[model samples]
Target: MSATAAERQFDELASLYEDVAPWPFRRDIEVPSVLHSLGDLTRSDVLDFGCGAGLSSRLLAGRGARRVVGHDASEGMLSAARQREAKEQRGIEYVSRLTPELEQRFDLVLAVCVLPYASTRSELRQMCASMARVLRPGGRLLALPLHPDHAPDPDYYAPYGLRLVSDTPHAEGGALRVELRAAGVEADVTAWYWSRNSIEEALRDAGFGPVFWADPWPPGLARVEDAPPALHAYLRRPHAAMLDCRRARVSG
Candidate 1:
């Protein structure tokens, strides 16, 4: 997880991120589990790092978060996010600058599919450090990463009898030329393939205690039901993870 690559790729694909994001339409694997893992917080200050399109930020605000500062490397996404926050009247502060503008502290830091894009260990470490720095001692951080063994192969995607193919690197999480007919849109997305172990170790190394994980989506409700038999079967098995963590204090 190298710094330069992840930032560069995110900056490149910021505009089209929302199209592939599981949003507005519907899905089971979503923010609830993420929220549940963090327990209840009424008016807690939150940070949505890599807050593309502001979906989760809006969700946090909708769920009684006092103030959610959205941070990302993509100006295009942040531009869209600002408009969205204005539309929702959510009073969210959106920042396109990652490290400098994110100097302020918060009650919680959410790293949603943000770190898997890191190309080197140092970049991944920085992402965790960013989350740690923003916390108010005893603050929480929620991070998600695709399970390595089940990581989505860039060459394969099976929809209801329609298969999507890409020459893009598998590490990108099949983001480019990404058209999901079932999901009903397209994009030049930038994503990543990462192991849960890699993600958890990074979090722990940054001084956060690991807490919880995400449940696989319920099929009857999401595209799982609509997916071809093979895909549906695969969906039932857990292929991703969400980690809940609390930043720790140094021993005196």
Candidate 2:
């Protein structure tokens, strides 16, 4: 399978990504919210878009999803995911992408940290539309796109395994590049900034709404005590945002 630029970047970073995500974004926020919101997945079909090494897919499958499909653009990441599925025997189906031929639709779709990889406005629009297409009407989408309000500052996120390596202005808007580092592991990733207006516009055009921005301290936080103390302050300020949206139902 051909790799997207973002996919190749992730492929090189996949091993380290399993160990060190950008901290608060993954551990303190997105993951907790996703698992909490999916309270009763007993018979739900779940899609983990950009499933990476399949961490979210396995989590959803074990939590009683009737079917869990992990779709990613990187073959390396999918290979690792399939290896784990082989060992664990979880009924997860990993694919490079959701094709037109696949008639199945999901009840819930989780796209944590997937949007910022889009380098262009049209790419982002296509992604949002593609996600909408795979969801059954009334299906829910949880998207964690990077916050346009918070472009990286030097030393701002150093405590959380991320360092602002560079920033440059683009015709599209602001862009920030950062390096994820921890204990002898390092990987460079770029996150494109999209205004809230553009993001909401894309979702609305894709037939999803009324989109709701999730609260930083979701009710799920009360159950997780392992989050580091430093996260509390950052939570109050928006570094990234969770967009909770539902596909609109068509009228008969």
Best by lDDT: 2
What CA RMSD would you report for each candidate?
4.9, 3.0
TM-score for candidate 2, residues paired by index: 0.88
Per-residue accuracy of model 2 over 1-252 as CA lDDT, tens digit each: 356675577775567767865455567676666677778899899889889999889889889999999999988889899998899999999999788755338888988788888777887898898889899999999887776555346466666667654445222445567677766777778777787788889999999978888644555355334456777545655466778899999879
User: What is the C-alpha lDDT profile of model 1 across 44-116, one tens digit per residue?
Assistant: 8899888877877887787888888898876666778888777778888888655554554788898776766
lDDT, each prediction: 0.63, 0.76
Error of 1 at 182 (Å): 4.4
Superpose all Cα atoms of candidate 2 onto the true structure and report the RMSD in Å to 1 decimal: 3.0
In angstroms, the error of model 2 at 180 is 0.7
Kindly give the stretch of ten consecutive residues in candidate 1 with the minimal lDDT sum: 157-166
